[model samples]
Target: MTTDELIAPGTTGPATPTRRGSLRPLLLRLHFYLGVFVGPFIFVAAFSGLLYIFTPQLERAIYAHELTVPVGQAKQPLNDQVQAAQRALPDATMVRVRPGDADEATTQVIFSRSDLAPSHWLTAYVDPYTSQVRGTLETYGSSQAGPVRTWIDELHRGLHLGDFGRLYSELAASWLWVVVLGGLVLWWGRRRPAKGKGRRRLLSWHATTGTWVAIVLLFLSATGLTWSQYAGDTITDLRAALSWQTPTLPAASGHGGHGAHSEHAGPSGPAVAATADQVRNIARRAGLDGPIEIAVPSEPGAAHVVKQIRTEWPTKVDSAAIDATTGQVLATLRFDDYPLGAKLARWGIDAHMGVLFGLPNQIVLAAVCVAVLALIVWGYRMWWHRRPTKGGFGVGRPFPRGAWRSVPTPVLIGLIAVTAVLAWYLPVLGVSLIGFLLVDSAVGWAKGGPAVPARR
Candidate 1:
């Protein structure tokens, strides 16, 4: 993703005074190696992502009984809906409630008891107008993905393999930008026309498609890495350092973040119960409205944090903290108050997941996925086309060895410096690139030199 344009494709690189170094050869080699090694993971990500993108619709359809309801003459108090859910799941303890602001949608009363795992919650869907419990379903994650969508999510995220499977996604996210950027640079500098036939035609289509979709790919890669295991930690740290972390309501101690706030801790003593209706009223007065979630306070003095969850454009995600005992507004945070980095992170993630602009976002994401899939296939086909037909069993001609030799000294130094910085910033990419270079160097050493000396 770094460095200026290098030599164009198919010229004797760096042989003339006007020309610069043959960085394209090195890029080609890196791109080739990364493509050959990491492309499958990227392909799987795209393929599964294609399926995952449409899952919101799939989930809505699949859970229509629980997610939707008929319009009624008048809506009951929010407590009535919460009571219906509590009656349905008597053994469970209600944790939060997401009211169906729209007439057709059902209110969701989520519960997490002592016996239930932290990651899983039983949600009772109640018709807000009728105060009738529609059904209960187990949902996960902050978005509250249900069974079907969660399964699809797991398939895309980790192949249902837990922590180990996450590595595949992390690797894909880590390498995707480099591949996209490298391919784009190669396509741009090569200056191939879109008019030729056979392999040429395929090449033109591949380059054109890749160039067009590069923006989305780059965005996806960046956002995806922010969710990655290793890179996410680093990114979170960086965000904290930059003071761009998501803003939260003031903590009771005034020193903790949302998750660490004492207000969220277990009951400290005999506590007053705060009804969903009471919390909703308090939250509504604070300016949060439309599909808001009210986190049931654990204790009387606990602050019941109600957050607006609508992610689509005109996103209303402001939140307020209300004292459960006094029912007074403790604090509030507006979406408009979020730092630039925090806002970008929020929008980028939502857009990546096809939630930012709803249907239009999904369409764009699906198109990007299709483009990525096509590019991978076309790349392999081009590789196969370049194979020595007359020779026994070898793929494309490997770009000439020692392509880095043609790069000018200063440019090479700058490239190395940029690479080192990137490596540190992106650990996975850095480590893998260093490993690839080590392997390439070792092979060259075994073949008899520090680097295979190739002429331009």
Candidate 2:
């Protein structure tokens, strides 16, 4: 049976009355408009995210020569590896070093290029056992992501258009939850299925699939928003003001001695402070084990910051600060001591990136991405089938004039308050919402009333 047959005659229009005082119609209008307008950006994000989760496999295959080595009889000292990396890049300054995760893995000796941006660095993969320089590659950002992973990550975040393009992603994330919840309400209030399956099947599939992925979609939207540029900063500042910031070792204040500028010195230069071996000893005393990251001190009296992050479920994130010259442990912070907000932020980011549960996490997130793509495709298909033959493509209908007047006063007030808060919380989303409302109001005024569908 057709959808037209399934929906009652008068109920097909936006002004149709219900117990909820036209709430369903308003939500339907919102759902339809957001889906039609925002669906493309969501599709791009999901597709790029799908590609990003496989980065581990892609990196392993593409960089095997640089990342792997045969298990050798004895491992070389950390400083020896650093010296080897320095010999390879004679002019570059040492940045940090990452211990290999396993016997067959190569240690990373990172170096900063004076000519490049501060965030850009070159990483030399050195065999831990033989101190042999395997290869070197330039990386970007704090995570030091390689060329391929960086490219994919940038595409996912900003389509490689930089900060300005980031708004597209933030916009998609902000509206995602609204569209999902609105979809749920519309599906629940939909008419009963007609006698035989036909056009009704489209609605059925769309609703069913939407319901199936609704919870996961919400989770993704919330977590994705936390990483957005503008919204993320607001969230961080809010959390900090609430005393929810993650605890970390305090920086050393006064310059303890000479060699404070060791980080700026070339690899061939004299040791400015404590050697890598001494810093490693200090980190060991602070209970950091397994693959660790040591950031070289960049200034006098600065501490050598050491961090260990395990990518499995129940992640182990711990860090310590060691006095660069004295090789004394300055401070240590463990994951178990993180505040509630900090823990949530850490776990959410890791899970979103498919690192929280290891391979299983990656597989599940990849499936979600696939489902999102499918949902977007089906949504567009439904819209295309329902679009009017004459007019340019648009959301089919909007609530009738003054339809909002029937909404309960309290509910209306609550919505307005929430909208105001959201706008304040995420300025970009707020601006976009205001723009949408302005355009919607202008069109309604120009047309003499809110636009309503021509009933089939």
Candidate 3:
């Protein structure tokens, strides 16, 4: 068939067929089907991720009262701040303390109660200088995000559906790269721009915007998949087996030799080990800086662990362990010692969150998000405009029978093998892919066998 003949009426086209005529049609079929069936989930994921990247600003404004205080003369001791926080939540057991980095910031004393799960804890913010409790709020997991950020994060991750909802995000993330790459192929295969107005204009816009944001979209997809519930575990295991886990400081050989001792001192025990203030001093003396977190020892002979994670580009992640009783530094790990894979993982996650390069990173992420939203909107417009009034939800006409035979045998086998491996790596994507294929087959059978082109 000639290129002119392939162009649909009223649509612009340099619909030139490439050398791999058979392969091009197959790719077009896949792209059209995925777009029609899977696009909504992608839209949701993109929208949620866009909102998540602005968490810093959202949190600052929402938590202003508890997170900030007036600059004052010499701050009170860390012990005093802890005491104030204790007074506010006497039933809670102290877990960690974070003395704010600036004079205007509030010190955070984190606590856990018997009723709360490990991931759910309470944080009491206290003014360091006055040792007065500013406020108390609930936070979750290792990220330690406040209530508002926690809600938004959960929404982004699982739509508040818990584990089941998580599948949606993961599935969306897994298929995103495929959808993007297929779109790129289709756009590239079309040698000439579609001419005319209406659907043609919409297609042109969709193709142009998609090409512009393809690279960014790919980055977003990769980083996003790293956090997916199922696929994420696969990635973690793969990285660990490859020796790519984040590095940590090693404990000094004799530091905890006194044998595990209880963190709390009894009336007869060695005078109440070192105070919280002493532990903080030990961390500082050990070379730790920039918004460090001091985890109080929970058991006897346990060392106080202090960690600092600064997400700015050239990211800094370091940790130290101190003997709780003697206030002596026991071990330390610096970001510079991390392996290449570990470093890349850190950088990728930080960049994904829009914090790696500070303001510029946020700007770039925001622009990509906006562009994605526009592309999705334009895509739907194109689909809507081109729908067949008489057909059952026009998802593009199918290719002719015997089209599969046109693809070379080796190429077909290779594609199947790749798909199988991907399915193994990402179960949700694999299952969804199979489900779509089955549904398409059933529909074709119902329509009296696979649709054959009247004239191709």
Candidate 4:
């Protein structure tokens, strides 16, 4: 029979001779199962993602005073700034020093103190010239920024489980691709519902919103996955590109052999604190604009690393690394210095946050967010509409006979496999989904069929 003859009139699509079979049902089944499994993560990611999108505004609102310092005269040398910061925060490790600027003229020396977990960490900002403490912000709910950012971070990861949390976030991020693709399939079914009728209107609404959201969802899913999967390796590559080398520690000296042991003891010693002019010149020669952060050498023979986030208007980016004892710029790196892969990694964050300026990008992201929200609502509606009249939890449709009957089982199996992979990375989420999977399987078996209708 012809394709048109096979398709019943006023139906959604042109019908096939038999039915669209093979991997389609299996894929749809997996999609549904995984969606239910990762539903909470998607919800959290969406909510937290919305918050993160406006983080700059959040910072401005919450930490107004802390983010600003009084304008002042010339600041002290880099060495003096480090000393001043150390004096105020004796036990803290001085990471880097940010120089003075026009509006916020005070120099800030950042120091961090480690605790049980890195989240239990603190950043101290010290003024250089006056040797006074400016302010401090902790990683989790510091005064500068409150519990909002903290909560967002926790939700973004896995509630402060540290490495495990990051792993969970990564898995969620990776599997988001499935959510985007499933959403597309579901969207495809929404178009041209019924001629000049309410069903058609609803379907048209869904289709329009879905089309807009599909693009942005794909954009975020792709970039977010890349960010989670490759950010660390990209950072490592960037560090390597800057020619950072770790000198091997000397072998333990025999009790009597001081002279031979001294040969491999390393570089002569850390040089005396350099002058302000020398430091400034070093920064200038290194091509760093805005504030340059100088990290004090912790021990003898250690090279000082000058780090800086160049926040000049229109170019809010970063640059950094090790310098020679004589103030000669040794290894260095700019944001532009990143290799193609690393550059893509940096761009991913900008894209994920919709900060890339052009109107099209912003409009697309906003539309995507709206689309996701609609999908969540409509998907729930579809589930509600399909509820069984016979008091069973299965979808309100019959399973197609023959091969289609076997589709849901294998789809369930594939979903389980995908869930297993996702869970291995995010233990808590994995465990939670396992519980969900069991309940889902129990309900499916009790109902004696797949929950949703299979297209025939």
Candidate 5:
């Protein structure tokens, strides 16, 4: 759809007053407060995300000895690499093994312990060719991010403040689309002088930058919402109800249970009668190949899970559960057979994480982040310039009140209805929007309430 379709039309004429309109004034107020208040959280998320996207290369340089090895004539067995990792961390429960498919890349054997934070584990990097354990590091999340990326990721996800801190990001994500769409509508709905300085210039930059990156911002906001605490949980429940979640191979015995190893995401299953390499070979023969991970069963009766890890476009995430004892493939789930929603979710997530197109994906993500940052900067500049300065000192004056009074009865009702439904789907957005309105109203009341609309 075109940008015009994505945005509702607003008052169109010279930026100067042609008629008093409710929608544009209300949008201006909402947009202003969102940028002034929630903007910092968004700034942090964007800046950290920008840094996190490029950490794959940063990690390689910083941990070369652990991440890479001298090329050998041929690689050793996955079992050998797992053994080396086992020697290094005998006490930890084995989670999964990632056999670095690249010539000089090291095999990564991930282990989990009760002491580690949820979804955080120890990853022992081993030389596949030498069966030597290079080193171990605490990795985070499904992507197995190293220290540098993990630090930035933690900042982006929750500012390293844990669960409570996550609210900030969720709040930012929840409001981002409104900010984006509102900015688009406002920018497009009105006309500005061909040339101006100060507030006008800032407005031009902010609107143009926001419009240019509008799609990316919306995508980022939506995808990022899926990772939030409140909204994410709600969306997850909705997905499960619709069976839109990514399909998984059943455990060896067909029994299902999660949490055996948080990172693996495979159900509890029957005991394995074979090694990781054997199961991996089984999956390979079944047509799964290219950068795969083998999750060792944590609980007895759990089968080995071999799944493709490549997240690039045309995702190769086909997974299989193997009964190593019987050498039988218990179950298989192919990307092609995934439900439509699941497929889109996968692609959206991969693109959001900057792995869908490799380097180009990273570049685009970085550019979008810079654009967002610039918009925030320019927004504040506009707000600053718009502040009352009579006597050379005053606070910023918000858009005149009573703008909502000009809204048509049907349009206002429709807007409220749409917002309510969206709030149900995205609770954070609803909660924050209410909170802003109440606070703004209270402050205005305390200051003698909204001023009477001025006549042109």
Candidate 6:
């Protein structure tokens, strides 16, 4: 046995297949299991990605008046817009007013308070010059676009289960390792290559496809998992490195010296109100094109923040901070400003958004979604191919079968029943399974059932 005695081969003992290192096998198994277990979530991510790619464009097309204004009229003052929005929602706390672009006709205002029905609200389509409200938009529940975005965002994160969602996403990402491994297995298994040499051109195509996808897959999983868990930590570390902190800038330390002294300030959270006027001026000077959001800092020694949602394609929009009491710029960060871990997460998000490489990236990801759907079909095909042809139930081999057999049917049925009940009770698992079953049903119908042949 020591000398490979099991391979009783006079025909040159089956050329020893390349044995990889420990990390390789472990990574391979992890990928496989994660992909299998988190298939449903992955599908959701992929499908949503396909839809989200054109979100901006789609919104523009559908909500023209709300998003933009006609050119040539008198422009509205930001302060006036805030006043009008406040009058309409007197109970709400005024957040910020957004100035329109060249083509935008209406000024947008947002108001929020903890006591409000939805807790957060956005209102727009007000004529800035007249300070008259044209439309009232309520965000919450199934009735509003806000809810739609929130739900989609939740699906993108973890389908709404906070920690459970995070855990599931992380676990699913771990499975991507297996998908990569299985992909490699299928590739390598297809053609046995000679050692220390390149593969054939045709084989190379398949190999590289698997290789490229695996690389991106690893990037997506690692970054995504880290982001779901430690984005705050990652950002905090980056901020510390950049030395963004504040109690208040001494009157003597004014704007000119602000940048140099940024490091001396200790840990600052976010501030509640930095002057809106000063923030607008800072953002405009930096050439930011969109409306700015000033986040009120909740902690002591925090920076007042402004978020600019850029209309630019591909790159990240930025959030800049200014000291509320001091009127000094604290920090500015786009998605790119994140640390390695967070940057990885941002890249994954961009990739998931199908905007990482622009139009080509979107097409590639959509294709991947289609491929995933096909793999599911192919997996079932492989499973069926190995199944006994007699159509009788069989049992005891490890995997669960829909066609129960050998052991007591009642026992198996009961087990499935109880397990399903538990699964349904667990929201994340339940939602994921429902998602998969819907996809599965579509695939099954498309492929035709046991009695029907696939259509040409």
The candidate maximizing lDDT is 5
Assess candidate 5 and give its TM-score to the true structure: 0.90
lDDT against true structure, model 5: 0.78
Tens-digit lDDT track of model 6 for 26-145: 223333333445666666665655565555456567666565554545655665665666667666554445555445556666555454444345555577556577766644321124
- In angstroms, the error of model 5 at 244 is 0.9
Residue runs of model 5 more than 4 Å from their true location after superposition: 1-22, 192-194, 252-258, 263-274, 454-456
lDDT of 4 by residue, 102-132 (tens): 4564555544454413434344555655556
Quality of model 6 by C-alpha lDDT? 0.49
TM-score of each: 0.88, 0.87, 0.88, 0.67, 0.90, 0.58
Measured by C-alpha RMSD in angstroms, how accurate is candidate 2?
Answer: 4.4
User: Which regions of candidate 4 are displaced past 4 Å?
Assistant: 1-31, 73-81, 100-102, 119-121, 127-131, 140-148, 161-171, 186-203, 226-277, 310-324, 334-337, 353-367, 388-456
Per-residue lDDT value at 199 in model 1: 59
Query: lDDT tens digits, residues 41-76, model 1?
Result: 999999999999999899889899999998988888
> In TM-score terms, which candidate is top?
5
lDDT (CA) for every model shown?
A: 0.77, 0.75, 0.75, 0.51, 0.78, 0.49
What is candidate 3's local distance difference test score?
0.75
In angstroms, give how far residue 439 of model 1 lies from its true place.
3.3
In candidate 3, position 10 carries an lDDT of 34
Model 5 RMSD to the real structure? 4.9
The 10-residue segment with the lowest total lDDT in model 1: 1-10
- Each model's backbone clash number: 0, 2, 6, 1, 5, 15
Instruction: Evaluate model 2: give its lDDT.
Output: 0.75
Model 3 weakest lDDT span, ten residues long: 264-273
